[model samples]
Target: MKKVLFATTALIATAGMAAAEVKISGYGRFGLDWNEANDVAGALDNTDATNITSRFRLTFDVSTETDGGVTVGGRIRAQAENRDGAQGRATFSSPQFHVAYGGLRVNVGNIWGAIDSAPGLYLNTTSVGTGIDGMGFNSLAIKGAGFDTFTSAGVGRGGIEAIYSAGGFTGHVSYSKQNGTAGTSTDANGVERTALMLNYSFGDYFVTGAYQSADNGRTITKGGVAVEADDDVIFLAGGADFGQFGATLQLAQTEEADSVTLAGEAEVGAASTVIAWVNSTDIDTGVTAGQTVTDGTAFGINYEYDLGGGVTFVAGYVNTAADDNDNSVQAGLHFSF
Candidate 1:
């Protein structure tokens, strides 16, 4: 439901034939989770099982179309999430806005990083998942020729992005600059992220790819500078839909390591798997340097049954390993309204 903020809003719609609509939508899930993840060599570490995790999100979509056919819209997202009994207070993401004409769109403010939002770059899982998963890998791991990842970098002063869709093809490009401190100090600890993506769909089949790079290479006056081109990631994904069944495969490669992710789904259920590893470990990506690393093999599966009224029952598990193997299986009621 939407409430008009001012009488001018209604009058503008009536007099200008403009569309000023606001929408509220989100989902909620709650269940048990067994997470044994840590920062340092905790592969052999044993932690508690029976923990709790839940997530609630609400998005406000506000949009308006001018009489001349220009459309402007924005989204405000409020979210509350929990992991292992650490239920933090709800928070809101900075709003993002878009201006669109025909097939081209420009976005500003808290735009999702290109690699993170690019279509066909990542596999879909049925259950809720923290981007960090069992395979010890996620989407940003594909920084092409570079070795660093900034796709999940903190929200900077916002960003700018553009998207275009034509026929069966769609293209996306984005840039975010987080220059440190006050003045123009590019040498300081800051992040500059750039990503380009392309997606195409044909019949029941589709394919997508992305090239992303980041400059988190900070330099010191006396010390030294981290190597440039050390954080490049590249990604690709393809799949087909067969009415009742759908399947997709995703691959991500960095200069130091690589990963593969697979996903499959039916009308009522879905499954996903991820495998990641390092070869000779020339670079410190994740695994032990100079040692053959198998990071870990992670898997997640879920089943859902619609209970009508935008509600359903969901059950799923996510597993990944570093030093030792760990996982989480959850069953809960999911709702959308």
Candidate 2:
């Protein structure tokens, strides 16, 4: 990371403001990706069995402290990525602004949702999961649900959130409303969501719970007819750490599906680490006839070898839960600054 301090005496002299700081940091990753699903024959074959994957990200964070010890800050990111044969143009993400005082903080614009920020919701890995791009995040406990997260490009989820932490407990709440016609009728087009999350940590263990409700948003198909309805989701998770080994368990439930995940991580040596997870889900297809319910299991394993100075070698393998039992493997290098 790099920091640049600016004395705004000339610009903020009348306002009597202190100096501000800007920090720049990001990461780069590149590797080879191989997928069994992409190596198929006939009309569905477009991508090669093996392809190069790469991404570059640069983030800018600006912050300043007020005379009363309050902190104000904002963050924006520029990112680009290439997968298979398609390359994306560099793009700048919408900014997220925050104000903090002690253990309480409030955020507006491109805000992080409560459910997405819950502890133990994600695996303990350098890239959050297996492979360079998380291999589609198949290991996550939450399945068939939409939630907000930090967006590296485009407008993102426009929302407002508040986070508070004290002692060993933390609480988060978020709300967002998309642009469209809003009403209680089944024909309503707009979507509104509200979420809450709470967590408590003690020693090397922690527990978390989160809930979210969507108003007249989720779509369900019944008898070949698409219908709009409300969705309510709940998530629970617990984790513990014992020396060089740690484990987490997560459970999630929604109107359409239920999922469970178990993840573990261990330090192999001074510079090596391994992580793995297995997930099982039961999904309701929402169709009154034909294939009303289905169940599947997926798993992944990842390994990382630190090369010092913000660089590491990473490799991973994943077996998806698709009906065809698709699988993928990736190996690459990741470096951050």
Candidate 3:
């Protein structure tokens, strides 16, 4: 209660002083999905999840700039899954706030880190396709069910991000530590994850590479049982354009101990298409073989229409196949105001 009041007061103060600019923005989308399964392995089963599913995002921002190439900004956002669940209600599940200065960004509360240049923070877009096939390295096909990358569905501590971009070289690093609720120790130790990226662009060709690492332990049982694990993700991508035709290739791999994803996207006229595949072999470290799955593939195509005004329409479909047979069809519209 006190924290929320303080935040609201700060916003009001910003509005009352200087040239405070306040902007309210949000977007909503809904889609129906059909699923088919051959070897049901996940919770949704092979049954068709046919229903009007929607997501809502609301954002508030206040920003100003100095005469010396310095800028300061603050933002608050709320996202709701399954619109019918709770549209306008205050849900503690989706609340994030942050303040930033120049190239340094400080985030408190709940936030997700962005590292993958091609994927970054956009792994769960309706147009982003499914599994390792749709958007390849940019897809959230790997996030656990009912898990939100930002704060682990509020089952952990808040997240933080630090980023800097200069000249042709840009770099970003982020970290997140999750701690369970006030009463339970379910996710007590939580998970510690971090990502770093470096990118450079020149003329009609651009290239970017990134690495991500995570340590998942903190909540393991006794008897010296070590559920703590680590992984190294590396990405290398480049793109070139010639007149009306352009092409892009992205290759990413992780220590075989985890998984590897390779993907490519091409732009022809106003349309772009993506094809990707992934093979994840859990380093049994001690587990079993057949149980240590590996084969997974994804293919997709996307179309875009520029509406002149800062508005665009994007739609796509993806087919994903893996140890657990799963598939989904999705599309979305993007507009900026």
Candidate 4:
């Protein structure tokens, strides 16, 4: 309570400040979640959770500028678990710092890579997809849903990102490196990613393309599967709005290559998942020297209606893993502030 009061007072104090600014914003939502087995023959079955989905985020946006017309800014945010989960205290997550001048900006710390933030790469729906945060039935797909390229490494290491804009065109680039190595298949000893994205918005339509190389990549699945590899992922997406409705479509592909890196994931019968639900092999790739690849394709589409007042109705379906023909459906009201 005391901290809240102090923070409120500080916000009020900065409200009228010109060279500096402070703002707080976030979102909240609740809904049902249903999941089904990917393979009826598999022991894994269907599950459902009702009336219990919610998340709260608090962000402190701060900025100031030197007399030279250059601006410096940063954001500090705290997020709780996505479902009926509690936090003992605010978990300040994804802190980022930036320097800006005209149309160019450079960022560092807790940065999302280019493919991760690329426009059109993912829909802007509040309930991004049918599965909340892609941990539900959507997980059955190889991509595990969304156009997310989020790195688990966070600032356990650090990252640098840059953004630029001119007229209707924008570009983004990012790089990050992780410390420590993996055993046979835990977190990698190191992880590196380089990404680039370009976007253009014209009239009522927008187009975007992105390329990313996940180097020394590391990922673990809910089924206790792990893989460390270098990924070459490319993405293209676009969206357009006609009157009150909007639609989007995206296509993504991963390059296939021999293993300089190894893949390990739980073997559900003979099926071993490559990353999340991203790719799999029916036959064991072997615990060691397995050649894993996610080469087919992943795609998504969604539609949304603006209800105004920071609220919108959203519904969408996704083929989380294109190779498996995995899909999920969701519809919900999203609020933004």
**Cα lDDT of model 1 by residue, 1-337, tens digit:** 3234543455565675555776677778776665545323544343455556677878778778888888999877887877655545677777788999999999888776667665544444323233222122332234224322222123433679888999999898888766577776745766777888899999999998887777764321211324444246778888888877777777776644566666676663332232222211123353323223245555555566667776766655555433464555566666776
Name the lDDT value of residue 56 in candidate 2. Answer: 95
Clash totals in order: 20, 0, 4, 8
Decoy 4 TM-score against native: 0.65
Question: Against the hidden reference, what TM-scores do the models get?
Answer: 0.74, 0.89, 0.66, 0.65
Per-residue alpha-carbon lDDT of candidate 3 for residues 182-246, written as tens digits (9 for 90 to 100): 77765446666677767777777778766667676322222344332334555666666565555
lDDT of 4 by residue, 58-163 (tens): 6677878888889998877766644423222335566778899999999888776677676654334354434344333231212321222432223423688889
Candidate 2, residue 15: CA error in Å? Answer: 14
Reference-based lDDT, residue 273, model 4: 13
Candidate 1 regions with alpha-carbon error over 4 angstroms? 1-19, 36-47, 125-157, 181-189, 217-225, 228-230, 268-294
* Model 1 accuracy (lDDT, Cα): 0.60
Candidate with maximal TM-score? 2
Best by lDDT: 2
What is the TM-score of candidate 3? Answer: 0.66
RMSD of each: 6.2, 3.9, 7.1, 10.5
Candidate 2 lDDT over residue span 1-337, tens digit each: 1332222332354365557766777899999999887877652556687888899998887888999999999999999998875656688899999999999999998888999999999877767879887888888888766887879878877889999999999999999876653464555556778999999999999999999888656676655765433357899999999989999999998766789999999999899999989999988666443332247999999999999999999999999887773889999999998
Report the alpha-carbon TM-score of model 1 versus the true structure. Answer: 0.74
